[model samples]
Target: MPGATSPLPDLSRPDVGAALFSTWSVGTPERQRATVDALAASWNGRSWPTPELLSQNVYVGTDGDTLMHHSQWTSEEAYLTFVRAHRQARVDEIDAAVPGIERNGIANYRRYRGFDTRTEGDPRVPGCIVAIKADFDDPDPDLRRKWIDLVIEALETDPAPSPGLISADFHLIVSGARHLANNRVEVLNYAQWTSEEAYDAAIAADDPTPEWERVRHFPGFKGTTAKRYRFERSFVRP
Candidate 1:
């Protein structure tokens, strides 16, 4: 990672070949904090044993009931190996501190495209992360690519810069049994913003924008959901 001082993960880091995204529902703001605290303690207590585990960045949803974990790995095989050998113990440790946490299944993805809109001389840091998930009716990779291209075109043709938008990195789900079972392809847009207020302002101003209309009406788009989060902490392997 070029900017070591920043806690935000470098979404386009070349060495990271795979990423795992998971979430936990803790039921309250207090539980959310406890979950993050327990996770940091658990990660720091041990000498990280898996060298392929590049980084684990934790985020707390602004909604007050969720925690998102974004982890980077050298390869999918390395992640599977770790899950088989050490995942249970780590899960148990966190569960001990925050019982009854609802664990959501993990999704695997690879970064496909990214856009950086930060101003050259600006020193502002991203204070909010907006994760937008889009699902399609089919599992065709070409369909996914086409939709992403439409998004890029929309952004590029916009007459003015989107206020508060820092960057957006899109990830396509890795095809596997889980995806086949669901019969849908998923895309995640990991976006960063200068602050929640700026994001809210953009949303308030977003109806009937000509550039976004095409994407909003694009065919084969099943549905989409978005959430805002605050970066809590990140642990990088030594």
Candidate 2:
């Protein structure tokens, strides 16, 4: 079967890299945006050792916390190296900037080997796809439609839409036991590409479009929360 982002890596090579997942909640909407901005800035200058898969969810419930984020890393050693080198410093910056963030929900990091998920191995320089899911609100129908158009325009504004992008199927995730399946929800991104370089280039394009500006200010944006998962195992088709 085909791999998630890119083609599976050759097992004959060295140790298959690791996949790290972290899940946490940011207290408020303002803090959520700030955290994402800060983390994005930190990722800018560093020579990222491995590719990453990123996804975010903002639940409407008020049980524990409403915001969460999910990010996948390339390898365990590489993730550990990055954490030892930058995690503490980044967290301090996050706390200082966004007072609402409490703590990383999962402290003990987890890793999943590549072999469990693919026939050969997971890709080394995988293309990344980022999706943000949100349940319907009073004003979400019109706003969600607008956001979808804006997103497509933003993507089209990029000149080279290939390379990392083998294909991008924007799924609605109609019915599932997933977070966004509650109501008139929307899953705004579904993409696949060849390499991380290609994906980055497509996103970091020279476009002055104000498409994303309006959505960023939308009321549905509670915060950019995430979760990290290790592939302990996966069921594949034969």
Candidate 3:
């Protein structure tokens, strides 16, 4: 993993209670990553809450407008504290450094399962990731758990039956959005594949059991959306 980012926080720690995912944007991938790199360096260990776990400065691809910053914190309060401080001042520095870049979205999620804290290097997905965020009414706890399991199976097995997957992470919303706000995605599913082309081919394969059919029309299924992210900068705790 040459050019790999370093000093990433470990996600496996029990103390790492929450994750903050913020998406920002710049006109080009080069500027998007460069600006965020500068912003991250500016706050490098200088802010509150400290983001003690890992942070992904993911902006390596040249297609999309949104670049994501992923960080893990010791607790929800610590996350909020960092958010407060970031909103108060650090954003100005970002704006000054990258005049056109803007924050596209922000989410604070309770890490539910499969964050893969065991690994000691940058995340190994060679191509890109498919991130799904969804909202649903909790009608049955048992059934919900079952659905989660089944979906995880899809991600792990990759309904496409390919070995291109590096990893997958799933989570449920703690309190990120509201139903009325129209952005209330309560559950999340993430999958990594060799390339965007591979993902597209898999989705088009007409296979129903592993990924699409098992979850999309699930018993308690409600609504969801997807975003694509290129493998960017990732870190591991020393």
Candidate 4:
């Protein structure tokens, strides 16, 4: 087990039941890039699974020129350190890097726990969603406002028929990071689904509507893509 490492720090097995799904808006391309680099560098110092299997992607929404920068981390402690270490000062720095960018939208954050299966027992796959991060972008502030309103409508009005999604949380990358780097990264959305199937199906719905495309795939966003793999969780951590 030369390169082998636990998905969860200090935990014997993967905690399949829990996970983290988060979305963020990092202002602009330059700001988002800075945030991404800062995050990678920060996580490099933390102990966790190999980075090779990790996934990251960026998407741009047409609704208001919003961009979503997404990443799936492999460690909970690494994620925690990321949050606690980077706050308001980080926020200020991202703003300083971009200059005069004001967003009226609030970011979301969540930590999902309790699984139907145990990651410790399963050899196929281990651990829950270590972390999910996304960022939004818009060319016009007014459009951003309108887009937010539309997003709220979709989240509430057009709820999924059989949503596998569970609890969701919210947060904004504030400022003044003594532990982590200085960069503003907002936590826009987070949720826990019952299973990977439910998660995939929830997102798999194909709607011809333009709005639907905006949610699934936006144009302004940019980043490395994701290559999926299938796994089953048989282990549990107590």
Candidate 5:
């Protein structure tokens, strides 16, 4: 795991056209560390032949039983090509190192919008990352777009949003192929905060925010789930 402490991905990077998000249930804190170590070893031990694989980041969940892998790619086509050629062998290598990882299915997405709240003079590094999942009852991509618009409008118009929110990047799950279709659509919010306490304070004060209330009750909005994590390690293409 040497040289594994790299910087997080630039969510607003124009060259990054697609992303893949997946999680694994490792069952214990010890296993969580072991899993991340195994992944870093696998990624850094050899030369990555696929130029399209821009970066891969690993996060250890605060709850002690989960690990999230967020990988950036040049395009979905490149990802598919990599999957066809290299995915399984890599999976086998990792499995041999750390067995019984209950992998959640990977979700594909494209960054649709992003907002950065930090000013020019700010020098704080984000200590917490929040992954928020907004689910809709309908599969229509238009509904997903409308809901995100509402969220952006609410945040933009709010007069006194909680401080310490570094940035929020919204992603829309890609849809089209039969294998990717579902009855529900999901929008993911990848948010960075100065600290876990800052995020907790915002959640405690959520009830009085009129802007948030409007977005919460928007039509077709089903429900949301969120989890917090600290960046564990990352690997970028050499």
Candidate 6:
């Protein structure tokens, strides 16, 4: 986000510049479950350019009724260009899907920071996810470097907070635009583990690794909202 982090990963390449973060609110618990599952099925069937790098659909609900889509593209400019050419057909398809559901706004993110541990994306896999979103203090270069290094180290050390981690992806928002519903992120991270049993073992150990612990105490971030979602996962990566 802040001029890219030193040597970036494949996900951080310039061609991989645009990301879609969206939330859909389906009224009531009953409808929420059905609608989310239906939408996931419908989305998997839709015709559109393949998401260039990544695509994810996650469920997070205290009441068991929420869904979010995280998708990546070549760039914001690339996405804008494609939308201009396909806006009408896309709208028509969406209109048909719109029976009694309300569509929430979307946000575009320009920078991607991924910390690889296990594999990247697959919704069928079962895992425990730790998702954090917050506004960064826009620190000087030194602190930025420090933060990034800690994130990388956190997942690599043996005896990590959770063993058998699959992967971790941290994304930052360089664009100023964002969704209005309690969602504005200078940074967002998603970390996945192999299973709840694996995660429990990490926490049960005598000493836990310092990766996530250290980052949590860093002073450069504020207004952080952190959540843990069980059975949450990223959609199949393209």
Mind sharing the TM-score for model 5? 0.93
Residue 202 error, candidate 5, Å:
0.8
Q: Write the per-residue lDDT of candidate 1 for residues 1-238, one digit (tens) a residue.
A: 2112247888899998888888889999999999988887788777775889999889999999999999999988888888889888889999999999998778788899988887689887899999999988877888888888888778777776676889889999887754312334789999999999999888787755575787777788887899999998788887
Per-residue CA lDDT of model 6 for 152-224, tens digit only, reads 7766675534445666677655444433233443566666666666656765774644667787687775556
Error of 1 at 83 (Å): 0.9
Off by over 4 Å in 1: 1-6, 178-184, 207-209
For residues 106-177, what per-residue lDDT tens digits would candidate 3 score against the true structure? 666654566332257755444676777766776444555566777666655653464455555666555543
Among all windows of 10 consecutive residues in model 2, the one with the lowest summed lDDT is: 108-117
Ranking by lDDT: 1, 5, 3, 6, 2, 4
Q: What's the true lDDT of residue 94 in model 5?
A: 87
Writing each residue's lDDT as its tens digit, candidate 5 over 174-212 gives 877732323248999999998999999988777546767
Candidate 3 residue-wise lDDT at 135 = 62
- In model 2, the runs with Cα more than 4 Å from the true position are 1-17, 49-67, 107-238
Model 4 C-alpha lDDT per residue in residues 1-238, reported as the tens digit of each score: 1122223222112331112223345555565556544544433433433332243333332222233433344544444555565435445655655555444333222222222222355333321131233444533334333433444444544534434544233323332333223233323333334556665676577443455445446433222222221211111112
TM-score of each: 0.93, 0.32, 0.73, 0.32, 0.93, 0.62
Task: Please state the error at residue 153 of candidate 3 in Å.
Answer: 3.8
Q: What global local distance difference test value does model 2 have?
A: 0.40
Which sections of candidate 4 miss by over 4 Å?
1-131, 137-150, 176-179, 182-184, 208-238
In candidate 4, position 45 carries an lDDT of 33
Listed per candidate, the RMSD to the true structure in angstroms reads 2.7, 15.2, 5.1, 13.7, 2.0, 7.6
Compared to the true structure, candidate 3 yields what TM-score? 0.73
